[model samples]
Target: MSAAAVAEQDGRTGPLERPAGRTCRLCGSNQLRRFLDLGVVPRCELFLTPEAVAAPDVSYPLQVWVCERCLLVQLPPLFTPEETFTDYPYFSSYSTSRVEQARTLVEDAVRRLGLGLDSFVVEVGSNDGYLLQHLVRRWIRCLGIEPSVNVGETAREKGAPTFTEFLTAETGALVRAIHGPADLVIANYVYGDVPDVTDFTRGLRSLVADDGWASIEVQHLLTLVERTEFDTIYHEHFQYFTLLTGQRALATGGLSVVDVELVDIRGGAIRIWARPTECAMEPSVRVTEVLAAEEAAGLHVARGHDGFAEAVSRVRDDLVSFLIEARRAGKKVVGYGASGNGNTLLNYCGVRPDLLAYTVDRNPYKHGRYTPGTRIPVHAPERIAADRPDYVLVLPWNLRAELLDQLSYVREWGGKLVFPIPELEVVSPAPADRPLEHPVF
Candidate 1:
């Protein structure tokens, strides 16, 4: 069967009717070339109870394709936004580093935009109002639009004026009617989650003042391929963007890229500063330079997506092999951080409790639950010291530095750290007898 037919059969259409073919979401092109397939996996966030874990969980094909015409890499929506985001479990405030990053961005935006009490700031997908809390503290007028009722209520309790509704073009108009057009709109790491990119950008354009700007951050596709960060691919993330694809996606709503900032957060993300085409701002030279780099790296062609499957396969093999060896050697191996991406990696590698005894998470909500698909028990970080596993596999490799420091006590028991991305390697502690030549992983 054709991809389009399969998608239609699976009930993947958005509110608007997609073109007949499996068209590109950005440019409406009919040329989408499939590249990497991660096989079928369960929803990343479906933490199950011991009773539910024994029952079969739903799974969907986790295949990715790049649009030949627009270079937008995306996965077909196997599940709807309402099915994925409503009553969401992932909260942004759980990570101190992430909260600090949001604060820094809010401070920078305030200083750069000359925001004051009169200025209005609106954020889409504002999870628990992590960023809006900073704006409220400055006594600035701000609002948060979040679809998840649980998180939105938490945001309201935190004193951020939040509306529990998805930001569609219609909702954007309503916001403008009541709150007025915002001086600045912020969408952090959410552009990939929406199924309708055009509608989401149109909503941004509708909500922001003509002279105001919208800042969006998305995981860089280049980094995904280069670092083999396939674990980031889950059902919740519908699209991936290079600078070229991002510009095209935004331009669909008459927004133009004004500036670009490469951030180290989320393994390598691009923060795009965009303004309506009517807002007379020149595009930054950095935008041109980044596009040049992408073109030079052949990101404009399908061949750039080649070899990604092989790279992912190698990581899967090496990680499984390492865990098997550790088990055979009678060493206890446990995972740290029961994150969504970690679930993807574990499910893809077929790692179960036999290979990895359990995983620990700092998030209280995830603690005492079992990871989706793998059924690995999730425990509090305190369990790690009590258990003193021989090897702690750090699942969220992007936050390795923070996790390693927080878990430094593991070294006291001669425990080693293991990371599964880029390559699977066991990081040994620095010898106490000599000064370390490199930072401890």
Candidate 2:
């Protein structure tokens, strides 16, 4: 289920009190060990308008812990879905790469499963109908179970049938009873924000037909640690999954993992294809291949993340010094994307408006707003062209390919793009002399 759907199911917001001790959300284990301590950080997605800057806001310990029992890297559930998704700012349609990815998934699934007009498909966390819109084009019957009323309405306006609700054990049963079992169930990047893993998996179980498949994509923990992608650890993301641990979580609700694929999206992610236990076949070679890779990386144990805390510190120090030196060099460095990743990176490094000035985003909802904790103002992409800053610190660095063309104009003023994650690298973008077929921003 989407975070909005879960938040809508129970109107009660999560308690703000921090628990003295917490068992791993993936397993009922008391042997969790802390490896990364980012200190108290505000919600990454909670962008504040200029007027809301002075409002009292709550922050939580942005820490990561690995479970000794199951090795699920996770943050304590410090937030309710309501706190994050009710008016969620992340619209999947904003990224062309994301929409294309969704289209590819729908195309492949339709061809593989032979989905037709009689087939019913359900996409949990279907923000703005980015995926279901493709299914609608193919005339396939589908429903988008979105949590955010604001986002889901956009889906409806696009002719994608979207129900603004969260997924739960009861929610799934109700949907199945009313709308019938789904031929395929898809949840893209929704697991990270869900507070209740077992119940939510059960909801997925109830929604799919006995022979139907459920496809879930989650952040690959190995990629996160190896690439130093610590910015993904936010209050809303409750757990990070390894193949072994993800298999365990799925089994909790009678879903068996049959196949898996590693994809380069959202930094890095894994697509797990599962089915009801009774109809599940022998695990695919792909599943074992991924598990072996995780084993080779020693991700099956907590020790695999041993040096990551130091690596995170190094990233922060490197980025902070780079910005300070750039400022000392009398260079202007603004940000490219006003995204959650940028917020986590900025707040962790104690960056303020003085160092960053402001960042620009394609989303108008964030324009005229301040980043949640850092208070860095966000404007439209055109701001860069007007100001002609010397450098652009790419915040949503994962989408560099998609954004580079749109930002190529920055090079007109000898502006370079800076990437801070995996390691900071300053790269001159596309040729300033080259003309764009059309302006994107």
Candidate 3:
């Protein structure tokens, strides 16, 4: 989810509206404490066109609470899958880096799992068949289970056969009828977004072959708080998982982690490889180490909510001051990446077009559209070269390295790019100078 404040066009859920007192969605803890109240925010994915900007829009509460019971951080309930996914507009192929990552992951799965021509691959939330497109190249058989009609249709059009519906136990049975069993399954970034983790994993179990493996990538919870990734908290992401909690969730669904890989992609990510408990792949020492660390930190204990609330306040104030100071200096500042994280950052900080000129995104669908709430217009990356502003404010700071490399020309005229959250800083490259190392946090 790119940081931005807009409604997710697919089937978005409705607000919980159960009058505050919410038990922790993960561990059944009533000791839930409120930390950040982003007011009512629209789905962060729903970018409005310039014309639609004039129309009134819907908004929902974006409050986040930490469960003392499970140390699980989550947003207050808002929007159902029907409201979020049914009309989803996001296409996975929009990002080159994402496509590359998908391709690489598919390759790794094939090699690690000994997948061959006879193997079957099933993907959950497989938008536009981004990874399947590569799997097909290897002459592998594949099926994509996508809930969104628009994206599923595109995946089918791309030649990877698809089921244009969400994966559930029922859907899994239907897929089993047609595809038999999948030798490999992928749930990249899907597990956390799903509310019914048990059902979703049940569907996965039904689809996977008896000895097959499934790889799920989720944002590592430790990394989220350690890095001050408040922007990652949004309505769509249901449960933040560390290896400890994730293993528990998977075990409940009759799966076990056989291996784990910490990836730098998506800020910080963990790709867990799992199979039936009968499978004998040895769990890595890293797994126990991570689980132990989480236990010591009381991830399952309900306490320390107030400290997090204070941290949220500190981050919010610092971000606001950074943007305000930049604007007061008469510097021309624009945002980079209109992703959902950027939206949460902007809205939470109360930033509007008054501070940022506009946002730049590589995704064409967002270009020329207005960011929800702030009315900041989204434009193509070329706008940076053409406009050549004094400063560029990066919303998806996790990708600052990639964006900086891509927009190195900003240094041609001494233009520097700014990072907001975590901390604020500028990167100015001399025309003939090599890349500079960002100050290590």
lDDT of each: 0.85, 0.86, 0.77
Q: Among all windows of ten consecutive residues in candidate 2, which has the lowest summed lDDT?
A: 432-441
- Measured by TM-score, how close is model 3 to the native structure? 0.88
Clash total of candidate 3: 37
Runs of candidate 3 with Cα error greater than 4 angstroms are: 1-21, 24-29, 280-282, 296-300, 304-306, 429-441
Q: Give one digit per residue, the lDDT tens place, for model 2 in 309-406.
A: 78899999988888888788888889989888888899999999889999999999999999988989999988999999987889998887787877
| lDDT by residue (tens digit), candidate 3, 21-51 | 5776666767665555667777788889877
lDDT of 1: 0.85
In angstroms, how far off is 253's CA in candidate 1?
Answer: 0.8
The positional error of residue 182 in candidate 3, measured at the CA in angstroms, is 1.1
Residue-level lDDT tens digits of model 1 in 352-440 = 99999999988888877899888999999999899988988899988866676777888889788888887775775444322222212
Which candidate number would show the highest lDDT if scored against the true structure? 2
Off by over 4 Å in 1: 1-21, 428-441
Question: Which ten residues in a row are the worst by lDDT in model 3?
Answer: 10-19
